[model samples]
Target: MNCVLCLIENDPIAIFGLKKMLEKTNYVKQLEVYEDGEQALHKLKPHLIENTPRTPDVIFLDLNMPIMDGWEFIEAYTAIDRPQNAKKILLYVVTSSVMQRDRDRACELSAVTGYIVKPVTKDDLKHVFEEDLQELWKNQ
Candidate 1:
Protein backbone atom coordinates (compact mmCIF):
# COMPACT_ATOMS: atom_id res chain seq x y z
CA MET A 1 0.00 0.00 0.00
CA ASN A 2 1.24 3.46 -0.86
CA CYS A 3 1.72 5.75 2.13
CA VAL A 4 1.85 9.41 2.98
CA LEU A 5 5.31 10.21 4.37
CA CYS A 6 6.96 13.09 6.18
CA LEU A 7 10.69 13.83 6.13
CA ILE A 8 12.12 16.16 8.74
CA GLU A 9 15.63 17.05 7.74
CA ASN A 10 17.82 20.13 7.13
CA ASP A 11 20.10 19.01 4.30
CA PRO A 12 18.94 19.63 0.75
CA ILE A 13 20.97 16.77 -0.68
CA ALA A 14 19.55 14.31 1.79
CA ILE A 15 16.04 15.45 0.99
CA PHE A 16 16.62 15.20 -2.75
CA GLY A 17 18.15 11.75 -2.50
CA LEU A 18 15.32 10.43 -0.32
CA LYS A 19 12.70 11.99 -2.59
CA LYS A 20 14.27 10.34 -5.58
CA MET A 21 14.53 7.00 -3.88
CA LEU A 22 10.93 7.12 -2.70
CA GLU A 23 9.78 8.03 -6.18
CA LYS A 24 11.59 5.07 -7.68
CA THR A 25 9.85 2.72 -5.24
CA ASN A 26 6.36 4.16 -5.83
CA TYR A 27 5.63 3.43 -2.16
CA VAL A 28 4.77 6.96 -1.21
CA LYS A 29 1.59 8.67 -2.37
CA GLN A 30 2.56 11.92 -0.69
CA LEU A 31 5.81 13.27 0.75
CA GLU A 32 5.99 16.35 2.96
CA VAL A 33 9.46 17.66 3.69
CA TYR A 34 10.18 19.96 6.60
CA GLU A 35 13.49 21.77 7.04
CA ASP A 36 13.29 21.39 10.78
CA GLY A 37 11.41 19.64 13.56
CA GLU A 38 9.40 22.70 14.62
CA GLN A 39 7.88 23.06 11.18
CA ALA A 40 6.95 19.41 11.00
CA LEU A 41 5.45 19.42 14.46
CA HIS A 42 3.47 22.58 13.77
CA LYS A 43 2.21 21.40 10.41
CA LEU A 44 1.40 17.84 11.39
CA LYS A 45 -0.22 18.50 14.76
CA PRO A 46 -3.50 19.71 13.34
CA HIS A 47 -3.93 16.82 10.99
CA LEU A 48 -3.05 14.37 13.72
CA ILE A 49 -5.51 15.92 16.17
CA GLU A 50 -8.25 15.97 13.57
CA ASN A 51 -7.47 12.41 12.49
CA THR A 52 -7.37 13.45 8.87
CA PRO A 53 -6.51 11.19 5.99
CA ARG A 54 -3.76 13.63 5.07
CA THR A 55 -1.84 12.67 8.17
CA PRO A 56 1.40 10.97 7.26
CA ASP A 57 1.59 7.21 7.64
CA VAL A 58 5.32 7.34 8.23
CA ILE A 59 7.81 9.96 9.43
CA PHE A 60 11.56 9.97 8.84
CA LEU A 61 13.16 12.22 11.44
CA ASP A 62 16.69 13.55 11.64
CA LEU A 63 18.43 13.94 14.98
CA ASN A 64 20.29 17.15 14.12
CA MET A 65 18.64 20.28 12.80
CA PRO A 66 18.95 24.05 12.95
CA ILE A 67 15.91 24.46 15.19
CA MET A 68 13.81 22.13 17.28
CA ASP A 69 15.86 19.00 17.06
CA GLY A 70 14.39 15.50 16.63
CA TRP A 71 14.40 14.81 20.34
CA GLU A 72 12.41 17.96 21.04
CA PHE A 73 9.95 17.08 18.33
CA ILE A 74 9.47 13.64 19.79
CA GLU A 75 8.76 15.01 23.23
CA ALA A 76 6.19 17.46 21.86
CA TYR A 77 4.68 14.98 19.49
CA THR A 78 4.26 12.33 22.12
CA ALA A 79 2.55 14.86 24.32
CA ILE A 80 -0.08 15.54 21.66
CA ASP A 81 -3.44 13.97 22.41
CA ARG A 82 -4.19 12.37 19.10
CA PRO A 83 -7.57 10.86 18.48
CA GLN A 84 -7.85 7.14 19.16
CA ASN A 85 -9.32 6.62 15.70
CA ALA A 86 -6.35 8.29 14.03
CA LYS A 87 -4.08 6.31 11.77
CA LYS A 88 -1.08 4.60 13.27
CA ILE A 89 1.98 6.69 12.52
CA LEU A 90 5.32 4.94 12.26
CA LEU A 91 8.26 7.15 13.14
CA TYR A 92 11.80 6.25 12.18
CA VAL A 93 14.94 8.00 13.25
CA VAL A 94 17.01 8.52 10.14
CA THR A 95 20.30 10.24 10.86
CA SER A 96 23.97 10.36 9.95
CA SER A 97 24.95 9.57 13.51
CA VAL A 98 26.41 6.11 14.06
CA MET A 99 26.84 6.56 17.78
CA GLN A 100 25.50 3.71 19.88
CA ARG A 101 24.16 6.24 22.33
CA ASP A 102 22.12 7.91 19.61
CA ARG A 103 20.63 4.62 18.47
CA ASP A 104 19.90 3.56 22.01
CA ARG A 105 18.22 6.82 22.81
CA ALA A 106 16.06 6.76 19.71
CA CYS A 107 15.04 3.16 20.25
CA GLU A 108 13.98 3.99 23.79
CA LEU A 109 11.00 5.94 22.49
CA SER A 110 7.82 3.90 22.06
CA ALA A 111 6.71 6.11 19.15
CA VAL A 112 9.81 5.31 17.15
CA THR A 113 9.56 2.24 14.89
CA GLY A 114 13.16 1.92 13.78
CA TYR A 115 16.42 3.78 13.21
CA ILE A 116 18.30 4.05 9.97
CA VAL A 117 21.68 5.55 9.21
CA LYS A 118 22.01 8.41 6.74
CA PRO A 119 21.92 7.93 2.99
CA VAL A 120 19.07 5.45 3.36
CA THR A 121 19.59 2.53 1.05
CA LYS A 122 17.16 0.52 -1.04
CA ASP A 123 17.55 -2.37 1.39
CA ASP A 124 16.54 -0.20 4.31
CA LEU A 125 13.47 1.06 2.45
CA LYS A 126 12.58 -2.47 1.51
CA HIS A 127 12.87 -3.61 5.08
CA VAL A 128 10.46 -0.89 6.21
CA PHE A 129 7.85 -1.98 3.71
CA GLU A 130 8.47 -5.61 4.42
CA GLU A 131 7.65 -5.13 8.05
CA ASP A 132 4.48 -3.25 7.17
CA LEU A 133 3.53 -5.90 4.67
CA GLN A 134 3.96 -8.58 7.24
CA GLU A 135 1.63 -6.78 9.60
CA LEU A 136 -0.91 -6.20 6.85
CA TRP A 137 -0.86 -9.82 5.81
CA LYS A 138 -1.19 -10.98 9.36
CA ASN A 139 -4.22 -8.83 9.88
CA GLN A 140 -5.76 -10.10 6.68
Candidate 2:
Protein backbone atom coordinates (compact mmCIF):
# COMPACT_ATOMS: atom_id res chain seq x y z
CA MET A 1 0.00 0.00 0.00
CA ASN A 2 3.03 2.21 0.30
CA CYS A 3 3.25 3.88 -3.10
CA VAL A 4 3.89 7.18 -4.80
CA LEU A 5 1.57 8.44 -7.53
CA CYS A 6 2.85 11.10 -9.92
CA LEU A 7 0.68 13.27 -12.15
CA ILE A 8 2.13 15.64 -14.76
CA GLU A 9 -0.51 17.94 -16.19
CA ASN A 10 -0.72 21.68 -16.73
CA ASP A 11 -4.34 21.86 -15.59
CA PRO A 12 -4.75 22.49 -11.90
CA ILE A 13 -8.37 21.31 -11.78
CA ALA A 14 -7.55 17.95 -13.32
CA ILE A 15 -4.70 17.45 -10.89
CA PHE A 16 -6.89 18.41 -7.95
CA GLY A 17 -9.63 16.03 -8.99
CA LEU A 18 -7.18 13.18 -9.43
CA LYS A 19 -5.66 13.92 -6.05
CA LYS A 20 -9.07 13.84 -4.43
CA MET A 21 -9.86 10.50 -6.06
CA LEU A 22 -6.53 9.11 -4.89
CA GLU A 23 -7.28 10.29 -1.35
CA LYS A 24 -10.45 8.24 -1.41
CA THR A 25 -8.62 5.17 -2.64
CA ASN A 26 -7.32 2.48 -0.28
CA TYR A 27 -4.16 1.45 -2.10
CA VAL A 28 -2.22 4.65 -2.64
CA LYS A 29 -0.32 5.86 0.41
CA GLN A 30 1.45 8.91 -1.02
CA LEU A 31 0.69 10.97 -4.11
CA GLU A 32 2.88 13.52 -5.85
CA VAL A 33 1.54 16.03 -8.35
CA TYR A 34 3.53 18.00 -10.91
CA GLU A 35 2.30 20.71 -13.22
CA ASP A 36 4.88 19.73 -15.81
CA GLY A 37 7.13 16.80 -16.66
CA GLU A 38 10.26 18.93 -16.28
CA GLN A 39 9.59 19.51 -12.58
CA ALA A 40 8.68 15.88 -12.03
CA LEU A 41 11.87 14.74 -13.74
CA HIS A 42 13.97 17.17 -11.71
CA LYS A 43 12.59 15.90 -8.39
CA LEU A 44 12.62 12.29 -9.54
CA LYS A 45 16.36 12.27 -10.19
CA PRO A 46 17.25 12.64 -6.51
CA HIS A 47 14.96 9.79 -5.55
CA LEU A 48 16.50 7.62 -8.24
CA ILE A 49 20.00 8.58 -7.09
CA GLU A 50 19.29 7.87 -3.44
CA ASN A 51 17.24 4.74 -4.25
CA THR A 52 14.65 6.17 -1.92
CA PRO A 53 11.12 5.07 -1.12
CA ARG A 54 9.89 8.47 -2.27
CA THR A 55 10.29 7.27 -5.87
CA PRO A 56 6.99 6.86 -7.62
CA ASP A 57 5.34 3.49 -7.87
CA VAL A 58 3.06 4.64 -10.69
CA ILE A 59 3.47 7.65 -12.95
CA PHE A 60 0.27 9.04 -14.50
CA LEU A 61 1.81 10.91 -17.39
CA ASP A 62 0.07 13.31 -19.74
CA LEU A 63 0.82 13.67 -23.43
CA ASN A 64 0.56 17.46 -23.41
CA MET A 65 2.35 19.89 -21.11
CA PRO A 66 4.25 23.19 -21.19
CA ILE A 67 7.66 21.50 -21.19
CA MET A 68 8.68 17.90 -21.73
CA ASP A 69 5.63 15.92 -22.73
CA GLY A 70 4.93 12.35 -21.71
CA TRP A 71 6.86 10.84 -24.62
CA GLU A 72 9.86 13.03 -23.85
CA PHE A 73 9.62 12.20 -20.17
CA ILE A 74 9.57 8.47 -20.95
CA GLU A 75 12.60 8.86 -23.21
CA ALA A 76 14.52 10.70 -20.52
CA TYR A 77 13.39 8.28 -17.83
CA THR A 78 14.54 5.32 -19.88
CA ALA A 79 17.96 6.86 -20.44
CA ILE A 80 18.65 7.22 -16.72
CA ASP A 81 20.07 4.49 -14.54
CA ARG A 82 16.79 3.44 -12.86
CA PRO A 83 17.18 2.24 -9.31
CA GLN A 84 16.16 -1.27 -8.19
CA ASN A 85 12.93 0.17 -6.79
CA ALA A 86 12.41 2.11 -9.99
CA LYS A 87 12.59 -1.09 -12.01
CA LYS A 88 9.25 -2.04 -10.43
CA ILE A 89 7.74 1.34 -11.21
CA LEU A 90 4.83 1.39 -13.61
CA LEU A 91 4.19 4.18 -16.08
CA TYR A 92 0.66 4.76 -17.34
CA VAL A 93 -0.30 7.25 -20.01
CA VAL A 94 -3.22 9.03 -18.35
CA THR A 95 -4.33 11.62 -20.84
CA SER A 96 -7.32 12.94 -22.76
CA SER A 97 -5.74 11.89 -26.05
CA VAL A 98 -7.94 9.36 -27.81
CA MET A 99 -5.69 9.00 -30.81
CA GLN A 100 -4.78 5.47 -31.86
CA ARG A 101 -1.22 6.53 -32.54
CA ASP A 102 -0.82 7.75 -28.98
CA ARG A 103 -2.27 4.55 -27.56
CA ASP A 104 -0.07 2.44 -29.83
CA ARG A 105 3.03 4.39 -28.88
CA ALA A 106 2.22 4.11 -25.18
CA CYS A 107 1.69 0.37 -25.45
CA GLU A 108 5.06 0.00 -27.16
CA LEU A 109 6.92 1.07 -24.04
CA SER A 110 7.88 -1.85 -21.81
CA ALA A 111 7.79 0.34 -18.72
CA VAL A 112 4.24 1.46 -19.42
CA THR A 113 1.73 -0.79 -17.74
CA GLY A 114 -1.34 0.66 -19.46
CA TYR A 115 -2.89 3.61 -21.32
CA ILE A 116 -5.88 5.32 -19.74
CA VAL A 117 -8.13 8.12 -20.94
CA LYS A 118 -8.56 11.37 -19.02
CA PRO A 119 -11.08 12.20 -16.24
CA VAL A 120 -9.87 9.17 -14.35
CA THR A 121 -12.37 8.11 -11.70
CA LYS A 122 -12.20 6.00 -8.59
CA ASP A 123 -13.57 3.04 -10.57
CA ASP A 124 -10.77 3.40 -13.09
CA LEU A 125 -8.22 3.47 -10.29
CA LYS A 126 -9.87 0.45 -8.72
CA HIS A 127 -9.69 -1.47 -11.98
CA VAL A 128 -6.04 -0.52 -12.44
CA PHE A 129 -5.30 -1.63 -8.89
CA GLU A 130 -7.09 -4.93 -9.31
CA GLU A 131 -6.05 -5.81 -12.84
CA ASP A 132 -2.55 -4.40 -13.18
CA LEU A 133 -1.07 -3.75 -9.72
CA GLN A 134 -2.31 -6.99 -8.22
CA GLU A 135 -1.00 -9.02 -11.11
CA LEU A 136 2.32 -7.24 -10.99
CA TRP A 137 2.74 -7.87 -7.28
CA LYS A 138 1.73 -11.51 -7.67
CA ASN A 139 4.28 -12.07 -10.41
CA GLN A 140 7.02 -10.32 -8.52
Candidate 3:
Protein backbone atom coordinates (compact mmCIF):
# COMPACT_ATOMS: atom_id res chain seq x y z
CA MET A 1 0.00 0.00 0.00
CA ASN A 2 1.14 3.53 -0.78
CA CYS A 3 0.87 6.13 1.93
CA VAL A 4 2.20 9.59 2.69
CA LEU A 5 2.68 10.92 6.19
CA CYS A 6 3.32 14.46 7.32
CA LEU A 7 4.56 15.76 10.69
CA ILE A 8 4.16 19.46 11.33
CA GLU A 9 5.79 20.88 14.43
CA ASN A 10 8.36 23.48 15.45
CA ASP A 11 10.30 20.97 17.50
CA PRO A 12 12.80 18.96 15.51
CA ILE A 13 12.93 16.25 18.12
CA ALA A 14 9.22 15.71 17.99
CA ILE A 15 9.24 15.58 14.22
CA PHE A 16 12.11 13.12 14.20
CA GLY A 17 10.47 10.86 16.74
CA LEU A 18 7.17 10.79 14.85
CA LYS A 19 8.96 10.10 11.58
CA LYS A 20 10.87 7.26 13.19
CA MET A 21 7.69 5.78 14.60
CA LEU A 22 6.00 5.88 11.22
CA GLU A 23 9.10 4.41 9.62
CA LYS A 24 8.74 1.38 11.86
CA THR A 25 5.12 0.97 10.74
CA ASN A 26 4.06 -1.17 7.79
CA TYR A 27 1.72 1.31 6.10
CA VAL A 28 3.79 4.43 5.67
CA LYS A 29 5.96 4.59 2.55
CA GLN A 30 6.72 8.29 2.24
CA LEU A 31 7.04 10.77 5.09
CA GLU A 32 7.38 14.53 5.16
CA VAL A 33 8.22 16.82 8.04
CA TYR A 34 7.72 20.54 8.43
CA GLU A 35 8.77 22.92 11.17
CA ASP A 36 5.63 25.04 10.90
CA GLY A 37 2.14 24.97 9.49
CA GLU A 38 2.78 27.77 6.99
CA GLN A 39 5.64 25.89 5.39
CA ALA A 40 3.54 22.76 5.22
CA LEU A 41 0.65 24.63 3.68
CA HIS A 42 2.93 26.36 1.19
CA LYS A 43 4.51 23.08 0.14
CA LEU A 44 1.16 21.31 -0.07
CA LYS A 45 -0.59 23.98 -2.10
CA PRO A 46 1.32 23.34 -5.31
CA HIS A 47 0.74 19.65 -4.97
CA LEU A 48 -2.95 20.27 -4.55
CA ILE A 49 -2.95 22.61 -7.51
CA GLU A 50 -1.34 19.91 -9.61
CA ASN A 51 -3.75 17.33 -8.23
CA THR A 52 -0.82 15.27 -7.00
CA PRO A 53 -1.60 11.78 -5.91
CA ARG A 54 1.35 11.94 -3.53
CA THR A 55 -0.39 14.34 -1.21
CA PRO A 56 -0.14 13.11 2.37
CA ASP A 57 -2.30 10.18 3.39
CA VAL A 58 -2.19 11.23 7.03
CA ILE A 59 -1.12 14.42 8.74
CA PHE A 60 0.13 14.57 12.37
CA LEU A 61 -0.40 18.18 13.30
CA ASP A 62 0.83 20.09 16.35
CA LEU A 63 -1.37 22.73 17.92
CA ASN A 64 1.49 25.18 18.38
CA MET A 65 4.09 26.33 15.86
CA PRO A 66 6.09 29.40 14.93
CA ILE A 67 4.03 30.19 11.86
CA MET A 68 0.40 29.19 11.25
CA ASP A 69 -0.58 26.71 13.94
CA GLY A 70 -2.56 23.48 13.55
CA TRP A 71 -5.91 25.29 13.50
CA GLU A 72 -4.76 27.46 10.62
CA PHE A 73 -3.37 24.42 8.89
CA ILE A 74 -6.74 22.68 9.13
CA GLU A 75 -8.49 25.70 7.71
CA ALA A 76 -6.10 25.81 4.77
CA TYR A 77 -6.16 22.08 4.20
CA THR A 78 -9.95 21.93 4.23
CA ALA A 79 -10.21 24.80 1.78
CA ILE A 80 -8.05 23.11 -0.84
CA ASP A 81 -9.73 21.41 -3.79
CA ARG A 82 -8.23 18.01 -4.28
CA PRO A 83 -8.61 15.48 -7.06
CA GLN A 84 -10.86 12.45 -6.68
CA ASN A 85 -7.90 10.08 -6.58
CA ALA A 86 -5.74 12.32 -4.41
CA LYS A 87 -5.53 9.91 -1.43
CA LYS A 88 -7.71 9.32 1.56
CA ILE A 89 -6.33 11.93 3.92
CA LEU A 90 -6.70 11.58 7.67
CA LEU A 91 -5.76 14.40 10.02
CA TYR A 92 -4.67 13.62 13.55
CA VAL A 93 -3.97 16.26 16.13
CA VAL A 94 -0.90 15.19 18.12
CA THR A 95 0.17 17.68 20.71
CA SER A 96 1.38 18.06 24.28
CA SER A 97 -1.49 20.28 25.27
CA VAL A 98 -3.83 18.52 27.68
CA MET A 99 -6.42 21.24 27.69
CA GLN A 100 -9.97 20.06 27.03
CA ARG A 101 -10.59 23.04 24.80
CA ASP A 102 -7.77 22.04 22.48
CA ARG A 103 -8.97 18.49 22.34
CA ASP A 104 -12.53 19.62 21.73
CA ARG A 105 -11.44 21.95 18.97
CA ALA A 106 -9.41 19.25 17.31
CA CYS A 107 -12.37 16.89 17.37
CA GLU A 108 -14.58 19.59 15.93
CA LEU A 109 -12.65 19.72 12.66
CA SER A 110 -14.33 17.74 9.90
CA ALA A 111 -11.04 16.54 8.43
CA VAL A 112 -9.63 15.36 11.73
CA THR A 113 -10.01 11.62 12.16
CA GLY A 114 -8.34 11.28 15.55
CA TYR A 115 -6.54 13.09 18.37
CA ILE A 116 -3.38 11.83 20.01
CA VAL A 117 -1.29 13.11 22.89
CA LYS A 118 2.40 13.90 22.68
CA PRO A 119 5.23 11.34 22.78
CA VAL A 120 3.42 9.12 20.30
CA THR A 121 4.48 5.52 20.46
CA LYS A 122 4.53 2.52 18.15
CA ASP A 123 1.55 1.01 19.93
CA ASP A 124 -0.50 4.06 19.17
CA LEU A 125 0.47 3.88 15.52
CA LYS A 126 -0.31 0.19 15.49
CA HIS A 127 -3.81 0.75 16.82
CA VAL A 128 -4.49 3.47 14.33
CA PHE A 129 -3.07 1.46 11.43
CA GLU A 130 -4.58 -1.89 12.33
CA GLU A 131 -7.89 -1.04 13.96
CA ASP A 132 -9.17 2.40 13.05
CA LEU A 133 -7.69 2.23 9.56
CA GLN A 134 -9.42 -1.03 8.74
CA GLU A 135 -12.80 0.63 8.22
CA LEU A 136 -11.41 3.11 5.75
CA TRP A 137 -9.48 0.39 3.95
CA LYS A 138 -12.58 -1.80 3.71
CA ASN A 139 -14.54 1.09 2.22
CA GLN A 140 -11.80 1.76 -0.27
Candidate 4:
Protein backbone atom coordinates (compact mmCIF):
# COMPACT_ATOMS: atom_id res chain seq x y z
CA MET A 1 0.00 0.00 0.00
CA ASN A 2 1.04 3.56 -0.65
CA CYS A 3 2.00 5.84 2.24
CA VAL A 4 0.18 8.74 3.85
CA LEU A 5 1.98 12.00 4.67
CA CYS A 6 1.30 14.96 6.94
CA LEU A 7 2.61 18.52 6.52
CA ILE A 8 2.64 20.98 9.40
CA GLU A 9 3.40 24.30 7.82
CA ASN A 10 1.92 27.79 7.71
CA ASP A 11 3.35 29.27 4.54
CA PRO A 12 0.91 28.96 1.70
CA ILE A 13 3.60 29.03 -0.96
CA ALA A 14 5.55 26.28 0.71
CA ILE A 15 2.42 24.23 1.04
CA PHE A 16 1.58 24.69 -2.64
CA GLY A 17 5.11 23.90 -3.70
CA LEU A 18 5.27 20.77 -1.56
CA LYS A 19 1.93 19.57 -2.83
CA LYS A 20 3.21 19.92 -6.38
CA MET A 21 6.45 18.12 -5.65
CA LEU A 22 4.74 15.40 -3.65
CA GLU A 23 2.33 14.84 -6.50
CA LYS A 24 5.27 13.98 -8.68
CA THR A 25 6.05 11.02 -6.45
CA ASN A 26 4.14 7.74 -6.79
CA TYR A 27 4.29 6.43 -3.23
CA VAL A 28 2.21 9.07 -1.45
CA LYS A 29 -1.49 8.25 -1.48
CA GLN A 30 -2.71 10.93 0.94
CA LEU A 31 -1.46 14.29 2.19
CA GLU A 32 -2.77 16.15 5.24
CA VAL A 33 -1.80 19.75 5.92
CA TYR A 34 -1.95 21.50 9.28
CA GLU A 35 -1.40 25.21 9.78
CA ASP A 36 0.36 24.77 13.10
CA GLY A 37 1.44 22.26 15.71
CA GLU A 38 -1.54 22.62 18.00
CA GLN A 39 -4.02 22.00 15.25
CA ALA A 40 -2.05 19.07 14.00
CA LEU A 41 -1.76 17.46 17.40
CA HIS A 42 -5.45 17.93 18.13
CA LYS A 43 -6.58 16.49 14.84
CA LEU A 44 -4.07 13.68 14.81
CA LYS A 45 -4.55 12.54 18.38
CA PRO A 46 -7.51 10.30 17.70
CA HIS A 47 -5.86 8.43 14.89
CA LEU A 48 -2.76 8.09 16.98
CA ILE A 49 -4.62 6.87 20.02
CA GLU A 50 -6.58 4.33 18.04
CA ASN A 51 -3.58 3.23 16.05
CA THR A 52 -5.69 3.64 12.97
CA PRO A 53 -4.59 2.62 9.52
CA ARG A 54 -5.00 6.24 8.40
CA THR A 55 -2.22 7.34 10.74
CA PRO A 56 0.36 9.18 8.74
CA ASP A 57 3.40 7.20 7.74
CA VAL A 58 5.48 10.35 7.46
CA ILE A 59 5.35 13.96 8.64
CA PHE A 60 7.04 16.99 7.09
CA LEU A 61 7.29 19.67 9.78
CA ASP A 62 8.21 23.33 9.53
CA LEU A 63 9.94 25.25 12.28
CA ASN A 64 8.20 28.57 12.10
CA MET A 65 4.45 28.87 12.46
CA PRO A 66 1.79 30.85 14.31
CA ILE A 67 0.10 29.61 17.53
CA MET A 68 2.25 26.48 17.77
CA ASP A 69 5.54 25.78 16.08
CA GLY A 70 7.24 22.58 14.96
CA TRP A 71 9.26 22.33 18.14
CA GLU A 72 6.15 22.46 20.26
CA PHE A 73 4.49 19.86 18.11
CA ILE A 74 7.40 17.53 18.42
CA GLU A 75 7.40 17.92 22.18
CA ALA A 76 3.71 17.23 22.43
CA TYR A 77 3.68 14.34 19.99
CA THR A 78 6.56 12.61 21.66
CA ALA A 79 4.77 12.91 24.97
CA ILE A 80 1.76 10.99 23.75
CA ASP A 81 1.49 7.41 25.00
CA ARG A 82 1.54 5.12 22.03
CA PRO A 83 1.25 1.41 21.64
CA GLN A 84 4.56 -0.40 21.36
CA ASN A 85 3.59 -1.70 17.95
CA ALA A 86 1.89 1.44 16.69
CA LYS A 87 2.65 2.40 13.12
CA LYS A 88 5.91 4.29 12.97
CA ILE A 89 5.77 7.90 11.82
CA LEU A 90 8.91 9.23 10.30
CA LEU A 91 9.07 12.98 10.91
CA TYR A 92 11.34 15.25 8.92
CA VAL A 93 12.00 18.84 9.84
CA VAL A 94 11.52 20.82 6.63
CA THR A 95 12.45 24.42 7.28
CA SER A 96 14.32 27.34 5.81
CA SER A 97 16.65 27.53 8.79
CA VAL A 98 20.21 26.46 7.99
CA MET A 99 21.58 27.10 11.46
CA GLN A 100 23.71 24.33 12.87
CA ARG A 101 21.83 24.63 16.15
CA ASP A 102 18.57 23.91 14.38
CA ARG A 103 19.98 20.80 12.76
CA ASP A 104 21.52 19.66 16.00
CA ARG A 105 18.33 20.24 17.94
CA ALA A 106 16.31 18.29 15.41
CA CYS A 107 18.74 15.43 15.57
CA GLU A 108 18.37 15.31 19.35
CA LEU A 109 14.73 14.43 19.05
CA SER A 110 14.07 10.73 18.71
CA ALA A 111 10.84 11.40 16.83
CA VAL A 112 12.68 13.24 14.12
CA THR A 113 13.94 11.00 11.37
CA GLY A 114 15.64 13.59 9.18
CA TYR A 115 16.06 17.25 8.44
CA ILE A 116 15.54 18.89 5.07
CA VAL A 117 16.18 22.51 4.17
CA LYS A 118 13.52 24.53 2.45
CA PRO A 119 12.23 23.66 -1.01
CA VAL A 120 12.31 19.89 -0.72
CA THR A 121 13.03 18.34 -4.08
CA LYS A 122 11.20 15.42 -5.62
CA ASP A 123 14.33 13.32 -5.28
CA ASP A 124 14.36 13.96 -1.53
CA LEU A 125 10.84 12.71 -1.21
CA LYS A 126 11.71 9.68 -3.32
CA HIS A 127 14.71 8.94 -1.16
CA VAL A 128 12.65 9.11 2.02
CA PHE A 129 10.13 6.63 0.66
CA GLU A 130 12.83 4.34 -0.60
CA GLU A 131 14.52 4.37 2.77
CA ASP A 132 11.24 3.74 4.52
CA LEU A 133 10.51 0.83 2.22
CA GLN A 134 13.94 -0.58 2.91
CA GLU A 135 13.32 -0.35 6.62
CA LEU A 136 9.99 -2.10 6.31
CA TRP A 137 11.58 -4.88 4.31
CA LYS A 138 14.35 -5.31 6.85
CA ASN A 139 11.86 -5.54 9.69
CA GLN A 140 9.74 -8.08 7.90
Judging by TM-score against the true structure, name the best candidate: 4
Of models 2 and 3, which has the larger TM-score? 2
Q: Which tens-of-lDDT digit does each residue in 38-104 have in candidate 3? A: 9999988877666466577678899898869889989988998877776677789999998999899
Show pairs that collide, candidate 1: none
TM per candidate: 0.93, 0.90, 0.88, 0.94
Q: For model 2, how does the per-residue alpha-carbon lDDT over 92-116 read when each residue is reduced to its tens digit?
A: 8899999999999899988788899
Worst 10 residues of 2 by lDDT: 81-90
Lowest-scoring 10 consecutive residues by lDDT in candidate 1? 131-140
Better TM-score candidate (1, 4): 4
lDDT of 3: 0.81
- Alpha-carbon runs more than 4 Å astray in model 1: 133-140
Taken over the whole model, the C-alpha lDDT of each candidate is 0.88, 0.81, 0.81, 0.88
Best-first order by lDDT:
4, 1, 3, 2
Candidate 3, which segments miss by more than 4 Å at Cα?
49-53
* Local distance difference test, candidate 1: 0.88
Cα lDDT tens digits for candidate 4, 40-130: 9999998887777679988999999999899999999999998887887789999999999999999999999999998898778877888
Global lDDT of model 4: 0.88
Q: Please provide, for model 1 over 1-140, each residue's C-alpha lDDT reduced to its tens digit, 9 standing for 90 to 100.
A: 66788899999999999988987887778888999999999999899898666788888999999789999999999999987777788889999999999999999999998999988999988887767644744674
